[model samples]
Target: MSARLTQRQRALQKFIEILVNLKGQMCGLGIPLVAAFENIGKENTGGVWSDIFMQCSSIMKERNINAGEAWKKALENNKNIYLDECDYEQLWDFGERLGKSDRLNQEKVLELEKEKLTIMEKKAREVAETRGKLYRSLGALTGAAVVILLI
Candidate 1:
């Protein structure tokens, strides 16, 4: 479970990085949000990150909603089974603030979320490394003891 959680955190970190890049392309390169999402989606391709962005783009194009609402809607529609409540909370916060202000502010929000996810990923990795080994060792010992008793 810890390993799976670590993977999810890493995926989220990559997702945030993509969002940062998407923001840069929109702000610095003057690309439209829908086009930017389509471009980024093509570049990243395959994975929940791409799917979420593509969905957001689709929602924005079809419904004429703002980026934040589209983002929140995409996240809600595609539930990540691996992520826990805390992870969802952070993601929800990010979705709430996305595209609500200037480019700099949006970048700041992405950066902060990235930092928080980094810390969480590190902690989850540590737990997986330590506790995973312990669990395996305990299971082996228990098996050996049972065999000895049976013999």
Candidate 2:
């Protein structure tokens, strides 16, 4: 139980570090969104996401990770790719967003994404610092209680 508590909190810490590095590269090197995504995904995930586009295609039919897949499709086709577009929102599949008229510029989307992620990073930092300790304590206390009850 304590391990679970620690694992979850550690994942959040990793998220913060990864997001910062991602934003750093974007601001520092000015790489394209697709290249950035590919590079970050591969580098951060340790090759689990080496070909995120291909992985996104495999996950397309599933409901999860739709926005991510949409991002991949936009890049693969060299079209503007907003994180979310209403016209493409209800399309129900990754393929539908292709060649759409309503897509936003990738650079603009990247800027917005970074801004949003900056705010998210701040919030994540708070949670990682405070809530993690609270949760870990609770987990340990709960385990102790269980042991007491068993004894």
Candidate 3:
């Protein structure tokens, strides 16, 4: 479970990186935000992250709402099984600032979120490694004890 959590955190970090790059593209290349999100959804298929981006893009295009609101709605519509409440809260905070400011400010928000996720991912990786080893050792000991008792 810890390993899965680490993977999810890593995925989220990558997603934020993509968002930062896409934001840059939107500013530099004059690409539409909806198209950027669509591209991200296309690039990252077969994941909850992709679904969120696609949903956000659809909402933005259909309802003509701000990106923050679209992101919040997308998050609400798609629940990521791997993430916890704290992770969801962080994501919600990030979504609150999405497209609510200038390009630099948006980039700053993404970078800060990325930094936080990086730290969290590292900590989760350590816990997964340590706890995995401990669980394996405990399992082996339990099996040995059971065998001894039976013999």
Q: Which pairs clash in model 1?
A: none
lDDT of 1 at 119: 85
- TM-score for every candidate vs. truth? 0.76, 0.43, 0.76
1 or 2, greater by TM-score: 1
- Candidate 3 residue-wise lDDT, 27-111, digit = tens: 5675677888888887744356788888989999999998878988998888754666777787788777776677677667767
Flag regions of model 2 displaced more than 4 Å.
Answer: 1-54, 57-69, 72-105
Per-residue CA lDDT of model 1 for 52-78, tens digit only, reads: 778888999999998778877887887
Query: What are the runs in model 1 whose C-alpha is more than 4 Å off?
Result: 135-151
Judged by whole-model lDDT over C-alpha atoms, candidate 2 comes out at 0.46
Model 2 error, position 35 (Å): 6.7
Question: For model 3, which pairs clash?
Answer: none
lDDT at residue 97 of model 1 (Cα atoms): 76
Displacement of residue 96 (Cα, Å) in model 2 is: 11
Q: Report clash pairs, candidate 2.
A: none
* Model 2 worst lDDT run, 10 consecutive residues: 78-87
The better-scoring model by TM-score among 2 and 3 is 3
